[model samples]
Target: MTYPPQHAYPASRTPGGRCPVAPSLYGPEPDGNALPAFYEELRREYGPVAPVTVAPGVSAWLVIGHREVLHLTREEADFSHDPRRWSLLREGRVLPESPIMPLVGWRPALLYADGQQHRRMRAAVSEAIARIDGHELRRSVCATAEELIASFAARGEADLVAHYAQKLPSQVIIRLLGLDERTGQQLIWAITGTVAANADSVNASRRMGGILSELVAEKRAHPGDDLTSTLLGHPARLTDEEVLHNLAVMFLAGNHTTVNWISATLRVLLSDPAFRSSLAGGHLTVDDALDLVLWRHPPTQHFPARYATRDLVLGGRPIRAGDMLLLGLAGANQDPAILPPDGAPVVGNRSHLAFGAGPHACPAQDPARLITRTAVDTLHHRLPDLRLSVPESQLTWLRSPWSKGLESLPVRFGPRR
Candidate 1:
């Protein structure tokens, strides 16, 4: 699953052009960290499938049931990923300039492709990611994490979210892609701007495209042992434009989700004493902590619109042709069908819908796991006393409809002597 680009919140409306009476899931809450509660409420009130407004004049079903999400995602023939099939966008109600376009907009990337084309693109991406050496990547991630933490270790205090969590993933991905430091820096800025989806988003999108195009050309002329070059040499024989778009997909999707995953893992490590003590007492491992976060506070709360290719009923709700279905990933993980009521998160359960399911499941989960675990492990090793500087309640989550990214993670620890 991918994140919806950050955008301004407009007024709310449901389908059929009527004033929205259903719960709206696209705006900020009075409590910045109330996403869990909100998901629970939706599930309790609507019985797993609830009518919700994604944007003004945009109505969709938020599928909060675990079984339903699995069925919908696996049956790609019935529920396709191609946004071109969305009825709202087709009827001129959802305009090109709409803020949600960055999410549901048609792209030539793997995220939007379907059927045979999706298989081809997915194979290319999966193969490219598979070729990377896991041990080498882990070592690179650990080293990057060490450098990031050392940069702030002497200060005794820092926003780990900004200084460490966000930077480590980008640097690791850049190294994997075999890009230079300057270009890597530029990619970071361009990606930030593009996902922000503000006045600069259009320019940021163009800038990112230009950067990817240049990298593709460079790799074509002088191939190297990197992801871009690997894609260029793949048997898929993807065109230059295809290479650029797929690279964009990998970079953009990989960085955003990994950043949030890192931040969320750190939040749990710092805020929950029992959880920290579990690690200290040897009752749990970092991998267990990671799994808990995946099940409880997933990096991506809700995935973007998946259009229904035909009329069908899911979770007792009738879905029409071309109707939008937003996968309630965090909600589904909390479903009683999977996790017993009042049950704690299972230590090694990897069945959560956090990375998605079926043919379109995220292809880079292994790399993401390595980066997150190494980052968290390195941080604790560097500063064992690290703790939150501010009260946990004072910390806020970024108010976006897609991912549960922390706004900042202010932390303090014993300064290095």
Candidate 2:
């Protein structure tokens, strides 16, 4: 699966007239897991904008500076959310089946639209999401969290990643979408397979599309009081295709990112003594820990990013038209200029690029935080004695190009009393 050296697709030249080799940003390489350090290295070597390859021969820039990332994501006029602007994909250099395609590939969803069209598409989603009852959503998250924890409480030991963090969000989202349990199970399967971007990614993606299409059709006819029905009836006048894709966006974005956020936050809570003591001693809140994780272990590491709409200079790197730019969310949060002089976590700052910023910024941040907070609070309330089952060193990170998540968070706690 290797390709020629990254120097083959360099964005700029070195002082010696040779192009600097862009490092690979994919695969199970060491950087895939220890991304914060990897990002630091990239920054040291290439400043704010570093050239990197995503898939084999798929070259792009990884924006690592805090300000640069802000500009890249915020200035939609200069960069586009539309993947059709991607030069490599447009010219057929990137294979259709490349694992990254499921993420960066275009759909009719607002996630890929721009300007007026983006505003139109986003209004429907934002309104639909807003229509959700906040108290009810919190209750569902608490009940789901308790139910999930109860399933594993008596076991004394469990992999929280699978048994709790992973299930709670999917189940809650299923309920929000008014999906039957069977359909919900299919949704979970399709989401996991597609986002994991394995050999079956393309097929899994198609399956997800089918599932969303059916849900849209069913909701259109029945028009329940669920999120799907809300989208269908929205005043934005979204077409069936628009509603389908937006629901897909909502479902996909809500589930996986929340899963990672919960898992990573729990990892920090379990492993870091200072965090635990701070929470226990009332110096910090669950919200603080969640914000810290957002900064330090952003759910997605390098976000699938904007395409240069026209030639431009960014962070002093000459970005040609149609060039891809991966938003280094974790890297930007770690930017030296933004950190304290002593390099400590900025406990209360909620301005990190974890959910990104600007028009296409994640519209579900509050819901995600609510879900994650309720899940963490419920688990600890039920099992105050919870502790890691394995040594911290034994925990493994999921080698996802996009996500920063533990593969599992095995823990031991007292049996239900």
Candidate 3:
């Protein structure tokens, strides 16, 4: 999982120049969690378009400027979202020869596909998200948040990550998908393991895929009103395998990313006493907290890997076809060019790359935002004194290139009034 050193591009440097893009600021020494520092370094060295080699043969134009990244994202034809190319690079396989090729052989999930295929899948799922009544869902989320907060509130100690923040979104996603209680719990565990970016995560993804395959079969025989059943009823429209793929994708995409958001938001809120007071007073709404979370600590620290389908020019550099493009979302969000010149402190409502953009933008963003806002609002209102139990230095950030989140967050607070 280590990439070789490569140079990042500056607007003025030729590809064959002596100017070296800085070394990757992560990996073995830092255990791959040095993204924040890396971003800062790149910003200092290359300005808006610094070139850094993330891995061998994976030299990407790290678009740090907000407008630049947005422009690249909008140009789907120029920068493809195909995961196979990146998968090949990761496995060190030559073009079209990766063992995981079969996995990505078909057009990737809606997030990775292009043209009509991507549009059709997104359209199908859009209805489900649009049909969801956010107000009702928010009420349910608040009720769940209260119940969870109350459970540990009496104990005066809890791991916010494991017991509260992580659980809230899983439960919400389960309800949204209309899964049964037992199935929901299993899916939550499976999805969490799958997204953690470890051997366990890989195994969990496969197991979840198998389980989804079986569920697809069962749904076909006995259709219901659930999302799974809806996919089943559309047999001619979507094959069983495609349904399973989308469902598996949904589980991984929806569960972990949202969990990270919840944890990071809580971390930021608890770390700042003033912000906590503002939250307690209702001066800052859940929406406010969410905006702050995205700006301050995006769920995923790095952008998902992208590939160039052909030779193209970006940020004043020529990138060849099949070149791996690492769109540094975290880097883009923090770019000074996008934010106000005075550099206003991180707060909610700042436009960011947390959910990505363009044809492949996350479709579940609305529901995810609604769920997060509701959860935060509920917790603040129900447990005003909730605060961290452990010192900030003792906390451990999850070590993964895929998501930026904590391994745990212990908190204690007075019992609900």
The most accurate candidate by TM-score is 2
Candidate 3: worst 10 consecutive residues by lDDT? 94-103
- Candidate 3: the clashing residue pairs are 8-51, 8-52, 9-51, 291-348, 292-348
**Candidate 1 structure quality by residue, lDDT tens digits, 112-187:** 8888998898888899999999999988988888788779888999998889888999999988887899999999
After superposing candidate 3, which stretches have Cα over 4 Å from the reference? 1-35, 47-61, 85-108, 234-236, 281-283, 346-350, 415-417
lDDT score at residue 145, model 1, on the 0-100 scale = 82
Instruction: Give the TM-scores of the predictions, in the order they appear.
Output: 0.93, 0.94, 0.84
> Candidate 3 residues 1-417, lDDT tens each?
111222463444422223455454233323224566777777776655565544332334566667667866787777777765543354554334322232233444676677788787777666656767778888888888988887787777789888888888888777666677788788777777655544465566667777777777877888866777765554237777777777777767777778888888878888988777776688876678677778767786666556767665665455556655566777788876777788765665557888887777778898888878777767766766777888886787765545557889888887643
Clashes of each: 0, 0, 5
**Where is model 2 poorest over a 10-residue stretch in terms of lDDT?**
1-10
**Ranked by TM-score, top first:** 2, 1, 3
Clashing pairs in 1: none
lDDT of 3: 0.67
Error of 1 at 255 (Å): 0.9
Against the true structure, candidate 1 reaches a TM-score of 0.93
Report every candidate's CA lDDT. Answer: 0.81, 0.83, 0.67
Clashing pairs in 2: none
